[model samples]
Target chain A: MTWQPELDELRAREAEARKLGGADKIARQHAGGRLTVRERIEGVVDPGSFHEVGAIAGQAEYAPDGTLKRLTPSNCVMGRAQVDGRPVVVVGDDFTVRGGSADATIREKPIMAERMAHDLRLPIIRIIEGSGGGGSVKTIETTGRANLPGGVGGTQLYHYTGANLSVVPVVGLGLGSVAGLGAARLAASHYSVMTKETSAMFVAGPPVVKRLGEDLTKQELGGWEIQTKAGAVDHAVESEAEAFDCARRFLSYLPASVHALPPVTTPTDDPARREEKLFTHIPRDRRRVYQMRPIINAVVDQGSFFEMGRMFGRSIITGLARLNGKPVALMASDPFFYGGSWTADACAKIIRFVDLAETFHLPVVYLQDCPGFMVGLAAEKAATIRLGVRAMAAVNQTTVPWCTMIIRNAFGVAGVVHQPANRYSPRYAWLSARWGSLPLEGGIEAAYAADMAEAEDPAAKLAEIEERLNRLRSPFRTAEAFWVEEIIDPRDTRRLLCEFADLAWPLLTPAPSGLRMRP
Target chain B: MAESPITIRAEIGASVWKILATPGAAVGEEEPILILESMKMEIPVVAPHDGVVVEILVAEGQQVEEGQAVATFRR
Candidate 1:
């Protein structure tokens, strides 16, 4: 006899799972200016490439005749999908179902998705909303008890969430009100993004936090502005569509996993291209500040620079770009903020970026222009020097090839980290480069105080000392002493960098370092 | 008023060196509205979007704390 009746039942349940959270709940989701989980997956991955798992795993109700009446699908919609034709795991929370709370969750589904990414060595993208199966007080009522902090399989959830970082690339997108475990998922990613208009992330949301006597709106509490400025999230976009675009672009610069080299695309921009503006880009006046972003855009492959955490670390710019079709990490100093000094926040930003580059085996190109570590009481309170030491250690321990160009000011201990010690790496200095333990203008008064005080005309004596020191400050003097490396014309920057990229590509090996990525 | 005006804040503690835009002046995105002097360098404060300057709360040579409102604008 044929088993066509059972086959028909299976098809019917799969169709029921496709109707996520019913029509009324989905309308409410749309009314709040957010998309459903299935829609989000479709927007982020390649068209018609999603293969959903556990489609029929959910609560089922049966009638008195021993036949199924209806099925309510699980809130976690997870599956394998392709991004730019590369396989990846996508796990999104269905906010239309029980507000994506733990009460309606099948806990094994999300854990299984993370396990799949870990075993298969594929990138995992988390589209977080609501709590992402985190704790809900309603769960206590449903089970008739209050359990411990970690749910039945929650430790495994956290384990795979963290272990996947060392093995493969992990990205997270905060698309709506996300709390607790959802917030942790977003924070524990190689790159994370949030929409400015529709996303808010926090450990606990407003209602619970209101008991602490702070009556604040969701936007005021943990909006895009607060999270991005606090360095909890990397980017904030204007819309969900833009957020998806960012995820796609970020993956383009990285490989599917640490076991493989980043894929190289055909070069559209000429490797020998050089801009004449670089020759006069740095202002003649030492006190003036010039834009650094344009200089970065001019040197790398055209329109390939992707900057991250722009709001948090205002002084240092960290991003990824391609040179001669090979991926490389780019770091530069912005003179507009504290004269490009290393603040505590900037140090933390650099540490994370350096770790990412080292883990992925991407060569680093640092455009040096640091004045020093930030000075004064605020700097001390923020522990700038402690973080600076940590940054130095991070740079010193990196095994990837490094190339540095001294574009402008380089002074003090912060400037000494242009390249790691005990390593022979390529380094270049421009005609405008000036470096020392301290800048000459303010340093003269501190060093020759006695000489000026003893002179009959102190002003003239000071001027004489300054003139003599200025002549010795020329970069060629350092070049003659062999203290600095080769000095080159600014117009030759791109050509020389492209040559370095050619040399660097052969040095990158895909063998795993056995070191876990620090989140 | 179709939308609320956006207030531009001083990002660092500095004295206003120059005010480039006047009240009711039309400015393009990223055009410098004023300059601030700090850390022996002149830093520019630019418009967040293409907008008209509606008000100047701080004048040239005035000392401004970080996060102080320096100007207001409408898109």
Candidate 2:
């Protein structure tokens, strides 16, 4: 009569179901080095936080005597759990049950999970494994029918998740072989991760790919390394634990849904705390390359930069850095890389980075040293202009505080786009700013081409023109004309930037905007 | 037979941008040697070591490249 008896019976049923198809089948799963659905859930979520929605519901099988041999619930686990004390809905596909084919996938579980997330407005974490509800050969035999080309269930889930994406942050953890719908689900997330050892996501597996005359391993076909580097997945972690940690960190910067603003954490550093090193961070010699990291480190709160897409955009550095403990998006030109030239990749990276900052209400601090967009035939072929314009659009569209510091080379359209509108521009600063059409080295020949051609002493005339242009090209001239703000010493950069941060902090008003489109 | 020592040299004379390899780290012949920054230009020091990097003679920010002995390793 006690409720404990019902719980005991349910536990017994699950154990008996696990023994379905005998000990040999269970051993095979063990040999593959995979944990069961329950085990995976336990590994990912906080310990003892999982509360299952459907435990005893599974597939129905029969014996030769025409009697029910076993009652196996759906091959997926759905539940609510607390990750870092924040409520989250979790779903994991159980590969042991018919490889998680669409035939055995119960309609109720996924719908229930999706609805729960939508109604409660909690983050939905889908632990995708197996083929993600694709119709199997056995499905036709079992149903005595074939699934229609576009099934209602698959369509419904797609639309539902797509709509929810703009409303809430959806995270996907690809923990095993994922194909078709599973791959799409992973792609739909704001942030996604795949395990290095056992997880992969592709349209089809190796066997299907081999039929089309291509041989590839599961890892090569859809490995985490390949996907993450290509930006198909945001992260590739060594283990499930690492993937879980990434999800937690990602969610820390976002609210439960678009309706709510991101929660702000108190800063550990004083708003006025300034480092003196920034003054001398940029070298006096234009030919010498100085480290930009030190300059960024000195300006931001100590140990607050969390870089994103560090490898993809070498010329432009993008990361989250705190000023007076308030999170701000830090984007700077690494002059060491192609003279801080905006390449196609760097442009695309900036577009996405700025979009994320705007979406999450993070103010942007641009430490400008941009020389210009990469030139030449190769740059044009790479669609550098198209991408560069988009990067500019993202920066301009952002309502968040947009502070800019012209630390060095600021030339051409690439340099001009660094600052927002003069009125809304986040308190602008110029430290020995080099502003012009381009650097003197490349333009000197063009500017004096006629003079050199006319002069009997061509070399001497060229030198004379270069010397005159260099004098006029100095930042002091620009400051005198008021083309730029005050031109301060490199050593005063930290204090100036800290002051800028203070001025911009009061202007940062939280917005309830949803995730913006990534370029 | 023992492999010959691979000598790492700078391609240009500028400040060191970054050191991607450390002593005893395995590197491919085509991998980034050392990143050099000159005139705000990043020139990679390609791996001379088809084996482990035996030593790193230069620290980051040290100006050296173009024939400067940055590191030597047994191939």
* Model 2 per-residue lDDT tens digits across residues A1-519: 679977776777677655533466556656776666777788777899998887767766678997556777677788899877888888888777777665566766776787788779888888887765546767788889887744765566666656666556688888788887778778777678888887888888899999999899999988976676566666677877787777777776666765565555676766556567665666676765666888888777777776655555567888777776566789998875667789888898888777777666677889888889987666799899999998887777777778787887778888878866535674445565777886676677777677778899977877788888888877777777887767656555555566766677677554455445532
Number of the top candidate by DockQ? 1
In model 2, the Cα lDDT at residue A472 comes to 85
Q: What are the lDDT figures for the candidates, one per model?
A: 0.89, 0.73
The segments of candidate 2 whose C-alpha lies over 4 angstroms from its true place after superposition are A1-36, A62-71, A100-103, A136-150, A211-213, A285-291, A335-337, A430-432, A445-449, A455-463, A488-511, A514-519, B1-40, B46-75
lDDT of model 2 at position A291:
68
Q: Which stretches of candidate 1 lie over 4 Å from their true place?
A: A151-153, A455-461, B1-5, B18-31, B48-54, B59-63
Docking class of 2: incorrect
Worst 10 residues of 2 chain A by lDDT: A510-519
Query: Fraction of reference contacts reproduced per prediction?
Result: 0.70, 0.22
